[model samples]
Target chain A: MDYGTTPLHGLPSRVTICEVGPRDGLQNEQAVLPVEVKAEFVARLVDAGHTLIETTSFVPAKWIPQLADAEELLDAITLAPGVRYPVLVPNERGLERALAAGVRDIAVFGSVTETFARRNLNRTVDESLAMFTPVVARAREAGLGVRGYLSMCFGDPWEGEVPVERVVEVATRMMALGCTQLSLGDTIGVATPGRVVAVLDALAAAGIPVDAIAVHFHDTYGQALANTFTALGHGVTTIDASAGGLGGCPYAGSATGNLATEDLLWHLHGLGIETGIDLQKMVDTSIWLAAKLGRPSPSRAVTALGDPLPR
Target chain B: MDYGTTPLHGLPSRVTICEVGPRDGLQNEQAVLPVEVKAEFVARLVDAGHTLIETTSFVPAKWIPQLADAEELLDAITLAPGVRYPVLVPNERGLERALAAGVRDIAVFGSVTETFARRNLNRTVDESLAMFTPVVARAREAGLGVRGYLSMCFGDPWEGEVPVERVVEVATRMMALGCTQLSLGDTIGVATPGRVVAVLDALAAAGIPVDAIAVHFHDTYGQALANTFTALGHGVTTIDASAGGLGGCPYAGSATGNLATEDLLWHLHGLGIETGIDLQKMVDTSIWLAAKLGRPSPSRAVTALGDPLPR
Candidate 1:
């Protein structure tokens, strides 16, 4: 073995990938695949050894009609015994719907930017967080796993440069209020490797454990992987990625999509890190869905692997 | 600074970027830009703070007709002071042509995989390296800088998993011949962060200094940035990138272009590395060139920064 070729230090040994395709990816799609197709996609991801699958969002139908079938999709999908299936909940109502659908894991979202919060959720940051408090309390009482999302943690379209102090405050508050994990989202794809480190450094000063932190970055700026490395260097273990690089953040103007799961796995697996995901199968599912949706996958990895089913 | 939210460990503080758009990007293009356009592109890249620009190839017109104007473009473009503009020279004939054109820096090409060499250059590995030895010797005598490129340093379509020993022998021989830099080219874009670390480790064990190494990876797998980080961890300082994510390796099946310069800068700059390149300006140039080529830039960073140009 060429010891010279292997990295001597600062390489992540294992990375926990949180596949957000089912929620973040499918939610933005205009052509909704049937609920069964959605379930099949999630199952395929599970079969590929993805441990954390964000199945669907329980947002009001009026808000995002595309994910109106979230309950049915969650109920219909076969749950792999060890896999964690989480659903997105906007408020107490959304959490009620998710709990009724037998969701054991729930995620609550809030925006660090005030403009994005008002535009996306029709509530101010304070209002949104206030609304989510009950939902988090209920979920904890119901013995459900809850993850808190601080969207636009780095920068926002309406308000650029989300203050690190504000992000830390919001994250600390969320985690203090029954949330087990806090993912800082770079909604507009503006986070650079430097800024990621800066933000992580700030969070570290606040005494947050590296293992509890997750990063959600968009590929819009094409810095997603680089940002991931910044997070990894900070010892962040959980990374959020979408399958096939699907799903555009509606609030993020001109942003393309999230980093693709296949691409993410390729890097993690290549580093000798244990991601526990199969690359070839994930490529197959992305191709299947891209064909059904009649849109090319935004993932270069999927394209390079070839559209296993050539139309 | 709300330092409590930051994760600690594994992040890079700075990064190195090598711009290859003018050479690797333009060579694979079908609709060749005029010599003036090429010259302008180089000037703009220099203005954008690109320190290392691979300007063009001295290969025969029959091979890559797109870059036949290499000499004219080099002559027309004003070489920014302190910028190292390197051109690819396949053998003695190519080197002679480049030398006559007043080229001060040249890169010699070889392949790690036997089949790829035969298919790409119509020469066997030994035959190709044998051809480069004389060119390397002549260039050394001329007091010009010489760099050796080992293509398919990662995986190859014709022959997969290029052995570290093969790469080591080729790289060691090139270094012995007085080459200042050895660029490991992932022609097929299949390298993961692990593979990158593995390859770099192998080379280091072979007694190669990390500072003398450069990496050229394709975004075919969307792991270029990730791989770059791994390389940085091993102390590899130079990196090869294409402007606007311009071109794919024609011979490497499914290989996309080098990682985009704008994207690379985003990551590097983020890592607190002083690349001295302006992000907004870089994106503007990429968008301008993408229009000139009558295609959307393959650079997601350019697209994400969308229309930074004043309307």
Candidate 2:
């Protein structure tokens, strides 16, 4: 009932920003950049004070060809002290590949919808969850921090709308699978703040602690920042954002991309929430990446703040 | 507390959208469209099921030349029986001009910041309010529904952050002057949902009903729709938005423009809140307007939901 902006809104004083530009962002880009460009982008994000960076995905080279140079990228960039590099691991083989590439932290992705699980991972929802369990266990046994991704948590293109209860059930099981953190992903970006609150409350009621949850949102419908704020208000931190909103998946009905790092930081800095992100540096990075990607960034702040108006 | 995406999140079942694209939107444009084009734009909006279209402003030609077509535009358009055409009146002379143009609904604009008032109206806040007293009286005596706009309610670029109480005071004074509704304007777009809730709750504590208040936001920081969602949660229904998020004022520090109607409709429709807007038609109007304005729209929905990717 406290309607004040004095940091008492249950938002975390310091939020962990998991920069996913190198892996999630570039993998969705139509034009694949050179491995050095990807490495530099990661290095720039690291320079911008992002402690946790999703470096790459260890899937087969053909699966996400844009990020095929995951190993090449990892080798080129210097791993700084206190910085965590988390890469996506689809299964044990992906985990092995990631381990071979010196990945100490890894993400395992699943889906709440049967259709997304089927189409994306070629497995049903239960099958995908079943698949992630061992991958997570193996990663944790390897002393790697595991981040669980629950895709289509809000709505799926084929499934219409996802129930919060279903999401909660799967999320709980994922956390039970030794996953350290769960990021409830709105893959289609249809989740509103109200819906976000609903999902988070459902997870809490099912005994999932707030400390174990991160909210990853795509800015498809411009609901990303608002949903992020709502998540923050619910004691959720560890937001996953892409530099320049890089991953615009055109095949996915309405997936614009992940929340832009600059856009997210602007709101956080304004609300006095510390993310330790040098926003001006992020903007410069986004502008630089926008050029390398051969497109404008979908970030509102990137467009509004400094980038020249195309008009 | 129900985390269900059901209809019961304290949001109004029906919401009113006041279209301010013409008066507020075009006035900020660098290039002025001719009177006929402006008239056609208004007609297109009316055809797209917007009942309340802010047709034009009756201010001096030199001040806001973009809307200098006030008389001509009002004269050209055929006002529908049920649709309300609200033209802005800056003073008694502007009101007289509006009345001469057969306007039945009018709006009076003011600023919460003394700096904005001095810059825009050439007076301090008190002096500007004093100047509007007779304008409101004349418009009310003529039986015209007068909507009041209190800008910089959340922030002022020159004066910095405006306290919620100062906003409430100016808003209360505006409502007392026979203004039918008071729009709390986040002119600088620095308002977050928490700030919005704080300001609205302060107003409610001051005995103002949420029904009599509307929120006007610019998408400067990508907080418009989120702020709107927060306002809706507080039982405030009426919202102000531009058709294409058309108003981008470069000089306003952070004020990008009004929240796009398409972006707003996208979120409301997603939440199952009814606005009676034909979103496709609105998109078409925006596409057409964007072409006329020689720039891509700042609206995410306009870009994402067909109308062609402006990237």
Candidate 3:
């Protein structure tokens, strides 16, 4: 009854959320929780009704020690029958380590911006895509779901504005490599709603359906929810979020949190879109996670639902 | 040049920002800065290209100790010709004080929820409206700008959902009382974009032009920016924001902060709407204010631009 008298329009009937807190979220955090604790966090998220939970990354321990216990964490947590636990794989070696651990879902990341690809992934755009080709081929042969993450699709701190045509080019190639899904990331949070609309349109023109696209926005400039609104208007239904709006870009020193899962859910549920995710349970998990990190959740919904000061 | 290749549609070319930090923002803060510092804060806001600033409140000292020096602050600050400083006056007594101080603009507060009016204002809605009638009349007689603020226009903590019809009725009365503008406040931050669109339409149907309306939203649920985008689509160009998201409600203890001025500027400028507000100068004022309060600004733009940690 509290849904208000207004009829909603131009949004999806349901949404699929991919929780990236365990991998992308924690990897940026300075404090590393124990592997057992990480497993517990994953189990709690699954309990919160998230079907696609990104549990860990297969990168070397030296690169992201926070998620270094990927194998241990994967073995320790319970994976529900309907749930998907995708781990980030940088290359064939990372993919091998993940396959050896019985991971059936994995994602490769590259930047649409050339500078980000070189500085972060140590390759040019062509080189990074080339490196991912064999990895995706192998994953498809193994009957696993492959996803591609395109970072800095909108703007980059160093490379400046990236053209939408360039993003479409990279995304189409990733799809051609047998990727089932591609997430467009506004890594620096400089995206506006109009730019999101343009990029989505351009990608559509490049033969990628809106359903194949997921939006990933950082909340550094507080444009994530608005940008998400724009994406929904374009019929893009999948979104990537971190619990507690976790994750800071180490590359961009001033970037803060991601678009929080709780914040995103609050708006989605309010719009009468079924995400199949429990709001209270997600809030509990975020509160628990923030406690482990010795900070309050930087999420408006979490704060609105409870006290914000850290215990 | 970075406004993107897609031209915006259904949005205004120019927007008027009503800076609410000094009044609505600082009123909730516990640490009271000296009157001199408050005066300097107003002057800095004027320098930041804000044409309208809610500088202080005329509420009694016992009620709001933080702004007890409203008179001294008004006298101390230099008033720029192009800028307007509006003071919040609760009733006849507050209005008399403001008039004696040579104030040119004042705002009276009411609520769409009767419970908020009865409990907080200690009067029923009818009694409060009756109380504001003479105040607005005298202010108009003195040729001063009179604005009306209606809180809990969306929903209330105790009253649940507020009907859009009720908001329209109360707002129409206020406008008839000679108030130039009526700002609808989502005091609890529960409104979605659809609800905002409906409410704005209802107000318009009631003969209140969208131009005579301003929107005020709490970022309690991270919906402020998204709701703002909806307002912009409806041609409601005036918005209320707190610098550094400085305000919190003592009644709604879980409520976090107001929508930050810097955060709003980031997207509005990105959307190519001219607000005349200087982003860097607003950041500087927020930084200075946060330092004086000995806390970090809870603003994403502040964090994205630089660290807001205590000095």
What lDDT does each candidate get? 0.82, 0.83, 0.87
Q: Which CAPRI category fits model 2?
A: acceptable
Q: Which runs in model 1 stand beyond 4 Å of their true positions?
A: A1-14, A201-207, A307-311, B1-16, B308-311
Question: Across residues B273-303, which tens digit of lDDT does each residue of candidate 2 receive?
Answer: 8888888899888888888889888787777
Give every candidate's TM-score on chain A: 0.95, 0.95, 0.96
List per-candidate RMSD values in Å: 3.7, 3.7, 2.4
Output the number of the TM-score-best candidate. Answer: 3
User: How high is the lDDT of residue A286 in model 1?
Assistant: 95
lDDT of 1 by residue, A1-311 (tens): 01112332576778889999988998888787898898889889989989999988888888888889987887798778999999999888888888888889999888887888888888988888889888999999999989898988887776666778888888888877888888889877877765788778888899777777899988986878878976886789899999999997876566679989888876766666778888889999999999888998989889887644221
DockQ of each: 0.40, 0.37, 0.49
**lDDT at residue A101 of model 2 (Cα atoms):** 86
**iRMS, model 2 (angstroms):** 7.6
By DockQ, the best candidate is 3
Q: What is the DockQ of candidate 2?
A: 0.37
The most accurate candidate by lDDT is 3
CAPRI quality band, candidate 1: acceptable
